[model samples]
Target chain A: MTTTRTPKPATAPKLDPKSRGQGWGHYPLFALAFVGLALFVLPLLGLVVRAPLTKLGALFTTPALLEALRLSLVVSLAAVTLSLILGLPCAWVLARYRFPGRGLVRALLTLPMVLPPVVAGVALLATFGRRGLFGPAIEWLGVDLAFSTTGAVLAATFVAAPFLILSCEAALENVDPRLEAAAATLGASRLRILWTVTLPTIRPSLLAGLSLCWARALGEFGATITFAGNFQGRTQTMPLAVYETLQSDHDGALLLSLILLAVSLTILIALRGELRR
Target chain B: MTLRADLHLTLGEFTLDLAFSAPEGEVLAVVGQNGAGKSTVLAAIAGLIPLQRGEIVLDGHLLERVATGIRLPPQARRVGVLFQGLALFEHLSALDNVAYGLRARGLDKRSARARAHTWLERFGIDELAQRRPRELSGGQAQRVALARALICEPQALLLDEPLVALDAQTRLEVREVLRETLGAFAGVSLLVTHELDDAVALADHLLVLDAGKLAQEGSPEQVIRAPATAHLRAMLSARRTGSTPDPGT
Candidate 1:
């Protein structure tokens, strides 16, 4: 009763082993690949290979360290929540609709992700800085964004939202709109279709995106520093804290980096489990 | 339960101008070659595709003239479509998929699940309610789709080749279930297909579309005996491949 017949023929693209006179080119490329993978992986292995086993106790007990870690979690989690609330719809628009300036909007969103994090910091400072366009109006309301915890969240969100937006959009794009159409024919309105049919179908992508956005926000440093000036226990997140520790407490900095990496990896694995078919 | 449509639409390289009616409880099979506008007719009627001119009336409601146009969105139309792929949500269980329409209509989760269970039971797929689309056999998927669509109690059902994806062995069984389901439907049904066997199995009225135009519309025996056009005669030939004069040429 199984459908064992008519297996699909896969077209695997390959180069013939016997025909090459490109040994010189092949060797360099092979060597480079070996070096590249090692370069990519060696540092991560080095973290475990060279840990300050004895000083780990002090690193965890520091009040400043705990506060920074707490701030990092709060800001990054908020950033991810906001990203889902906002970016999911934005992703839908980018994925499903065609309009003028769509390509431009997509590219600009990538700016925070691709540009040097420090340069993104400068960009954010210019836009939301005290003397920036919205700064005067913002200050007049007795609300100070610069050098504040909210500033860290805003800064993280600026860079992190793009990750969720792109990932969720791609997931939404892959969902067959036919299913949504099918739902519509069943007496549902557009909004109803989105909430009930469309959202469930694209849930994995949204989850994946938020996880990535949270990871990105957690690792955010330059934008947080520039937009919200690092102040320990106030705006200094784990990354900012790590930067401060780098000068005087190298072991502590490494410990914080390791924790961040471990947490992000766990999140990614959990997210993948959620998204799997 | 009756459905009426007068539609004209232009999509990229093709145009569709169709006027048709399916009385309550009748199953109308739309037979056409590729790009013959059969799918376009369904999309237009479902309000998925924009129409340059036309209106659709479903069970006495002027569906085409609302602010959104006689083309109320696919959701508001309450017309069920068994898309060619069956397009089940890959992530959801069969029960959840069947409950999709009820939820979209804003039913409470409890009521939706109950209705979905009723639908699955009717389709005889209740045992497979927890299975995802990928886990179901082709016939099972089709049944799930049918159940999902029927649960809404749509005024009309539009099926786009419900059996095309099935292997030969499975298609016969699925076709039989589809036959029974169509017979049981209290509303109008329209099945779009290129296969004569499929059209004949579930539909009483047949439409032959050639190049975005309706070449002929009648019962299957009538079409088989006296095809309206030579192109249609060639199409009617059992072989999947055959040549016909281009309608434009």
Candidate 2:
């Protein structure tokens, strides 16, 4: 029996990446994407274009601006540190363990991320204000968390911690359980494995979370004003200062907004690289 | 010294019940199709998974006794495992990966690194010590993982499909390295593989498993000459045909 094979093509058709999705179908998508991009870009451009550049020297010398910048840095750093200390265990448990209501617990922890900043301030006030839930106990300890710098820090932490928790939980979930098992077989304890294996493995994402948390804390205004009550050097951070100065000194407010915009843009760019890793 | 395990584990719809013993300095290779619970057996012995019932005794020390509710954690088991993926610490340098167990045991960084360097030399990859796991070739990474596993001097070593990640040529090279390195080790070793060549070449005893139960058990030659179950016969014929069976579950 003789078998004859059909003649094959002399050359296979190579896929040209440039030709991919290059049709009328992509126009609407491109148009919508550019529209969305413009929505975000326009306001930022407006901030830069409308700025009084001639007063830049004077803007840099404002005592209120300097004070607000210092408070914003200190408060955001403290909030991120607190989030790392408290949210890491929560994130680990959410990622590595299975139990009833685990999903509910995760959802509740993430709720703060979506919650309005003002509402978060209200929530904080309900829990820690002088006439609130833990008011008596807190007073007994000789501490006042309301209308103070600590209150601004608490408000920032309340709204910003969920970012760290969610990022860490995602990173933790992606970690291979087998690596931890291998570490265990090498006689490394749980704490040792977490220190030498888990954290290092998730360092990039952890840093991303920390930066996101810091950025959120730095931009906190509604929560800080509602809970901590703008007290200049004590409780008024950059965002709060921007809001206050906007009602009076418009130029100073734009300068403060630019400082915040610069910092947030830097954080977002850094976070993008971290997330890419 | 001997390592003995009688494990009965039930995970979801699958159940595993097996008992095996290997004297010190011997390699027992478990060959099975995917989902035969071969890896499950290793996990149970290594204390990564708990057995519903059964006791594991290594060198006359009870590692697990479900009846008495006494179970040692994996850290206390002193059972080294080279996972299927090799599970090398990707963030660490090859030297740091090998030194991890020593550092965990409270050795200072300088001493731990010095000892790890010696292990890297034993594996003939001392020059690659500063390179991360991702920078190494498949066979080179396998050497690093092997060095990391043995650096702690475990009482028993468990290897899960150690060669599955390698290409054909790399597999042969790694298999040769495993043969020479495992020869010098004094611990009872359990090698889990689906390849009959690996089982015959590296194992002192071969245990054929099918559907979470032991299908046959004997020396490599004995098992090959007399395939006890259909699974074993199929594996033998596949080997004869020079076709690799699917290793994925």
Best by TM-score: 2
B75 in model 1: Cα distance from truth in Å?
3.2
Q: Which stretches of candidate 2 lie over 4 Å from their true place?
A: A1-25, B243-249
Per-residue lDDT over A1-277 for candidate 2, one digit per residue giving the tens place of the 0 to 100 score: 0111122346988999898977787788999999999999999999998878789788778888889899999999999998999999999999989999999999999998888888988888899999999999999999889999999988998889999999999999999988998899888888888998999999998998998899899988888898899999999999888999999989878877888999998888867877789
Residue A85, model 1, lDDT: 83
Ten residues in a row with the worst lDDT in model 1 chain B?
A: B240-249
Q: Each candidate's root-mean-square deviation in Å?
A: 4.7, 5.6
Point to the candidate with the largest DockQ: 1
Model 2 chain A worst lDDT run, 10 consecutive residues: A1-10
In angstroms, the error of model 1 at B111 is 3.8
Off by over 4 Å in 1: A1-30, A272-277, B65-71, B239-249
What is the CAPRI rating of model 2's predicted complex? acceptable
In model 2, pairs of residues that clash are none
User: Candidate 2 on B79-172: residue-level lDDT in tens?
Assistant: 8898998999999999999998898888999999999999999888899999988888888888899999998988998999998856666777
Residue-by-residue lDDT tens digits, candidate 1, A195-219: 7777887787777777778889999
Q: If you superpose only chain B onto the true chain B, what TM-score does each candidate give?
A: 0.91, 0.96
